[model samples]
Target: MRNYQPATLKKNVRLASKFAYWLDCELSEMTSANVEDYLIHLHQQGRSAKTIKNHRSAIKVFCDFLGTRGILQDNPVLRVPSMELPEEIPIFLTDEEVDKLMVIARLDDMFCEVTLALNTGLRMEEMRRLEWRDIDLKFKQLTVRKSKSKRPRTVPLNQRTCKALETQRERYGHLVYVFPGGKGGFYNRGIWTEPKMRSENWWQKLSIRHIQEVIPSLKNLPAGRTGRGWHDLRHTF
Candidate 1:
């Protein structure tokens, strides 16, 4: 069966498979022209350049996977034209902005999110995948099961990270997850019910509100889009 089932691939794999399906070309037909056409198709679909590049990469991986299975003699992704991404200036919080956020933290969820993002370089996916069993207070470390690569990595829990986890432990016991589970268990409906290991959403949402609240002109402005808002603190270290 020459079946290309997009659903069976893992989440990331599903993305790549969809690209192959949309292109309507066999893995054997992959070439520079084919890749250019696929990228054009994605661009026409209102995908940003970055998104188009990502889809191409995903398809590249799919081609490689098929090549390994002897479905194709060569992987065409090896020769596809690469996208030249525009350079972006780095964004980091100044001492004043950091202090301002801390001053406004109070007992809000955003406060903890700010502290943790500053302390650890955990991605949104890693935070969402956090499990109670992965943390070892005795070892003073947090274990991260790599969602993308399926590898496990550990980072020493800083004082703030430890305190945050401890507080969450006391507040939401028996949930078996670092953050909280929903009424349906792991189906994150929203803030009141989002599956998370260490969610900064409350912090993110609150921070956005606080920004709009403080700046009159920004009240009606769109939210920040260039860099990850919480990521500034992550790069602070």
Candidate 2:
């Protein structure tokens, strides 16, 4: 729990529960072979390497807990081999794709968010938490205080990003969040009534789906290319 986020903790708990349910015998009878077999089962189910790794981690933690309480003489999960993930190439949008995306974004009233994402390479959560107070337009810089690393950093603004911010300011500068949610709050995960509503998760998925429809290459990406989120915009930057 020291380093785990709330979401991660919940996921680990869920995975551990599933692993326990899969074992026919008592918890004390569980072994490394069982853990390995479960991993193989996950692989057979077409779960991605990253997902299997997470499952393995949760099982390890569960086994460690059992060992600490003398439920097991040894931690069986320790004997399980670590999962090896295949190399993944980062995918970014082509210049042409960006051009088309920008045109569509402008029409959809997402120009500011798209512009900031491409230019600053900020994560969706970081952008969602952005507020007017964190930006210094006079100095052309903004502070990301709630970054994934939990460390604040300053990001410089280019002319394009500055212009986009100026436009956003003129429109919704009085709001607390730079990109307020549908109800004028921080962006949250959910469907919205209007496409212009800014929900980072939904927006990324919607945009990617639209782009894939327009860009044949994206729809025909080779195996192992798996980017369907706003992080792709960061990579594009």
Candidate 3:
């Protein structure tokens, strides 16, 4: 935990915690079967391939580290079958699709968020929590303080990103969060959930409806229960 970045440490810690609960036994009692079962459990939960891969990596790293310290007889992860993942290639929108997406994003009042994702390749979670201070428009850069790798990174902003961010500053810079929902509150991460999708006035629903209308194939894109909206924008970048 001390060696890992914040996000990586959190993921590893969560993996340990969940594995402990699932095994209901000491570290020495863990076995390859237990690891396999945990992977199956994650699959059953509708976790994406990337998410399950992360979990597997966390568990493998944890077990290997402990095993070297004489805390266990074997690394169970090594004995478990490797996860069969689909192709690593991500779906991306072409220039025409992007132009259409941007038009719809504007109509749906999500232009800033959509544009930021396309320019920065930020994850949905990262974008949801971004603040005004994170962007340094003068330098044409934005800092991702809380990244999946635990290490912070500053992404360079292009002319399009800078322009969009400048516009966003005029609209939302006074607030603490760039995308506030309630009084001085950040947007809920579950805004794209099935329940929220049913809302007649939710911004996500409006944006999604328009985007799918423009790119009908997106409606059939395979995503888990959480669905993939702006994530494809990141890929498009």
lDDT for each residue of candidate 2 in 1-237, tens digit (9 for 90 to 100): 556644467778999999999888899998889999999999999998998999999998888888888999898888988888899887788999889878767655677888999999997667767888898999999999867687899999999899999988876776777776664212322212232424545464445566666666466543232334466689899
Instruction: Give the alpha carbon lDDT tens digit for every residue of 47-165 in model 3.
Output: 88777878888888889778888998878898876767777667788898888887766655667778888888997667756777888988999888877776789999999989988
lDDT for every model?
Answer: 0.62, 0.76, 0.71
- State the displacement of the C-alpha of residue 47, model 3, in Å, after optimal TM-score superposition: 10
Model 2 residue 136 CA deviation in Å: 1.4
lDDT of model 1 at position 55: 77
Tens digit of per-residue lDDT, candidate 1, span 107-183: 34445445666678675556666777887877779888764445788888877778877776665545666666433
> What TM value does model 2 have?
0.78
Best-fitting candidate, measured by TM-score? Answer: 2
Query: In candidate 1, residue 157 scores what lDDT?
Result: 83
Candidate 3 clashing pairs, residues 3+ apart or interchain: none
Against the hidden true structure, what lDDT does model 1 obtain?
A: 0.62
TM-score of 3: 0.63
Q: Each model's TM-score? A: 0.63, 0.78, 0.63
